[model samples]
Target: MLKKLLIACLLLSLIIAGGLVWSYQQVKSSLDLPVQTPENVLITVKSGTSFRGLLNHLAEEKIIRPSTWTRWIPRLEPELVRLKTGTYQITPVMTLRDVLALIASGREHQFAITLIEGDRFIDWQTQLTQAPYLKHASKTMSEAEIAKAIGASGIEKLEGYLLPETYHYTAGTSDIELMRRAYQAMMSLLDEAWQTRDQNIPLKSPYEALIMASIIEKETAVDDERGVVSSVFMNRLNKGMRLQTDPTVIYGLGESYDGNIRKRDLRTPTPYNTYTIFGLPPTPIAMPSKASVLAAVKPAESSYYYFVADGKGGHKFSKTLTEHNRAVRDYLRTLSK
Candidate 1:
């Protein structure tokens, strides 16, 4: 009876060892197997997704072969169980093991949103709304609430606060967080420009310089014209003359602007109309480039106080209204020709 019991115990041990080796081989095969995708595919691992759940999803998508052995992989490599929530790219060249490693590493694909110079805040909002995988938390909030959420409290206007640049972010990033980064970037550069500004500039504060920059951004797209345009506005400010810029009038018109600046529109009174107001508008009209901001603080030395489109995709600057009127006449003549 004792011999029989010993033989039975040995047989049980051999069976257990053989089962363990088979399980190990199955797990290794599952890990080494390539994902079944013929092309690159994007997969979103939502928050609170379990490792088993992710594997089940991959099997459902036909991205990987279904197997019970995959359960042992996470047990052996504990890090694979901590799935990171993000959008990941799975390619045909990737194995099931590679996909697991990528998800575990939390290296999600990056996306970019470009906020263009001279574009309005409304335009940026539109872009944010259309951006994929980004949480649209700002959609439910008011503009004031958004400003506060982004830690921009006490700001009268949200426009011109954010720097215009291509911002990169991973999936699940909030719109407010993106905006906050842009605002911080703008503040950093604005602060630097303000501190190193020419002391003789007529602008009182950095905000005022930003306001001037916004105006310059609207006036021209020519890189070389920014400094001269800054001089024109600065000279006007120093001489106590009304800015009389048509862009200000158009901005005040808002949705009512019929794509043309009429004589009546210029004469109309609005808070944003520089023709009616004595100084800078209450807030910036649009986002300005860093070059425009720099030009505002360091204006060229000139007596010029007037400028008009020269009919050649550029402007004609003049020191006197008489010269400006002549330039306008020449511009009109060119248009007729």
Candidate 2:
């Protein structure tokens, strides 16, 4: 009887060992086997999705087999259960373990939108509306309404408020949210620049600095010339002279501007007409980059009071009207050639 009992115990232990080996093999095979598909597939995991629901969805799409093993593996591994909510691209050659690891790692698909320096507010609106990935909350809203939605209430205009940069976002990001981020970024930078501004600068407030920066942004594309251009404006402002900047006149002409700034356009009366006005424009004409903003508050120490395009993507600085007229003549001669 004792010998028969011992044999029974040995047979039971052998059966348990065999079952363990079979389970291990099955798990390994499931992880190593790739899904049967001809092309890559995009899987959108919505927020608040349960782990079981995600597994069921994968099984329904035939990316993985709907077996007890697949269902139990995630339940057994605590690290593989949680998933992030976003759009994920899955390839046909990826194994079940690869797909699970990819989703669990939370590396979701990213889309980008760029806000260009010197772009008008209307241009920003058009680009935001055309972006397919962003949720269009402000599509039909007016600029004022959009400003209010982004916590910038009572703003008469939206120009020059947004910081120019490339923003990355996922599928559910809203236009309003992007606008808010841009506004905050500009405000933060503007505040820092304003606090560190030069002593007794012409700019009285951060908004005035922003206005000057916008003009500087539109005036020159040369990165190193921004400080010199800013110095010209600062000198003019200190002497209580008219800005006489052509871009401000062009902005004032609005739709009536035919890509040319005639003498009559400069003489015309408008709030943005710095040619006739004695100070900065009431609002910014375009988005100003951080560099331009910094140049506005910290202009170079120079006596320059005027600048004109040198026909080489740069400008020639002058301290007197006679010198400026010569630079203007040189510019016209090149243009006529």
Candidate 2 lands at a TM-score of 0.83
C-alpha root-mean-square deviation, each candidate: 3.8, 3.5
Instruction: Give the lDDT of residue 336 in candidate 2.
Output: 96
Tell how far residue 122 is off in model 1, in angstroms: 2.2
Runs in model 1 with CA error above 4 Å? 1-40, 67-72, 75-81
- Each model's lDDT comes to 0.91, 0.88
How many clashing residue pairs are found in candidate 1?
A: 0
* Window of ten residues with lowest summed lDDT in model 1: 74-83
Candidate 2 per-residue lDDT over residues 131-156, each given as its tens digit: 86789999889889989998889997
lDDT of 2: 0.88
Instruction: For model 1, name the residue pairs that clash.
Output: none
Which number leads on lDDT? 1
Question: Which 10 successive residues of model 2 have the least lDDT summed?
Answer: 69-78
lDDT of 1: 0.91
Name the top TM-score candidate.
1
